[model samples]
Target: MDRSQVEIEEQGLGANPYGLLLKALTLIPSWHYFLAFLILSLVFLYNFLEFHFLQDLFSGFRGHPVCFTYNPCSVIYDAVVSKCRVLRGRYCATPWLSSPHLQTVFLNFNGRPPVFSYRRQLFYTSDGGTIALDWLMKCDVSGGALHMNSSISRNETTPIMVVVPGLTSDSSSAYLKHLAFNTAKHGWNVVISNHRGLGGVSITSDCFYNAGWTEDVRVVINHLHKEYPKAPLFAVGTSIGANILVKYLGEDGENVPIAGAVAICSPWDLL
Candidate 1:
């Protein structure tokens, strides 16, 4: 074989440069090579231990393996999420919770900021008052205008999830936008219900939304439902807005328009 062909054959058989290293190590003492291998093994073991140790140290202990108290129910995976609640809230969490260890850790303690790139749609709270929503549409028409003027058919039964953030936050808040992004990715219609005068929307009313005030929220949910009757409506609220949502649910009771609701970290009894 030619010199080039022979060199190519050697490289093909030892892609990891084993031939060069074997020759180089031959010139060195056998004890030195053994010491080098020992060092590498310790490094690998130390790295492995450090990764798991640090993760456990930072993440804190997980929720009890047995779901809730007073019931001998052992292990979390067996318990249905909807079985127990703090104060008998309106919403029911899904049962059968299972996730990878690394995933659960990140999800529980994912402090990273959220990134949002939503197309907004404006809605009028009252005749003169208006609010802007970060719209996440999944219409059949790709890149078509889904602005306030664009007409999406009521026949489309998109699963809609409306998000309301904390008192100080808006559609762009890390928590709210993260949820909207994930839900939209799963083919659900997600929208952020920005409080009046917030989220870069122009303020037209003298009144700003508060923890107890569900008027604007009511209006937004009703308007969206009316516009898209075929689609199912679900609302999720955070912080003060969560209190408002619960109040709305309590007031409306069985007559509430939406299919289901969720409230998180609500200040129910703010004395």
Candidate 2:
């Protein structure tokens, strides 16, 4: 072989291009490899910290006690019972009565258009706090003058159903509207309890409500009970409202005034 041929053989270009590329990769700066290793190490540390320590800590404190006497297990038990399973002694009932009606009302204006009419009427609590409510009234032709917005009537014998909505919801919510419509079709009076700060009611106070806030509900129920002393009262609540209703019932113990209650999708743990 000549000198040029010997030089080309020494370079080994025709042997394997991938081998040459691998040799070049070894020559890469140490800083690049260090940075890659550092990124991998940080990712592993983050995952380890999150899964092993942070997750356990959060789980341990998931439902921290709100009151000294508050028993979370009781709340959980009530929630499970609210599901309406294990009828009598054994065997679950199909198509539970607590199931919410599947109907969606985007916006209901009663008789007026959305731009001109207000669906809910505001009322003041005993503590001077204000709350918005939607009423389903019954009519009578007797001498009694019925308030158009009140959820009571003079001659109607059907029981009243009060519905309390969850977070970020109001009387016009789909579930609330559906419940009202269904109960009304069943010849019953219905009312939707819109929490303070929601349902377009100007919140007069700076206080925000939580899962176990039942004072507002109690006040509303008291008003209804006084107004319709003979009629039965039933309450149904969803999500956070369900928790509040359950808590109220538990707190009341044997003195609960309402005939029956149904709670759906309640979160017993509020921490």
Stretches of model 2 off by over 4 angstroms after superposition? 1-119, 138-151, 154-156
Candidate 2 lDDT tens digits, 1-271: 8999998987895678899899999999999999999999977866644323343345553422222223546864567544544332332112221112211221233322211122455778766678887775433211223345444454456788888898777876655656666566566777788998888777787566778688888888888787777888899989899998989999887676798898887886778
lDDT of 2: 0.68
lDDT of 2 at 55: 38
Clash pairs, model 1 backbone = none
lDDT of 1 by residue, 159-246 (tens): 8998888887887776676777667666778888998888988889888788888888888888888888999999999888899899
Least accurate stretch of 10 residues (summed lDDT) in model 1? 90-99
Predicted structure with the largest TM-score when compared to the true one: 1
Deviation from native of the Cα of residue 33 in model 1, angstroms? 55
Give lDDT: candidate 1, residue 167: 85
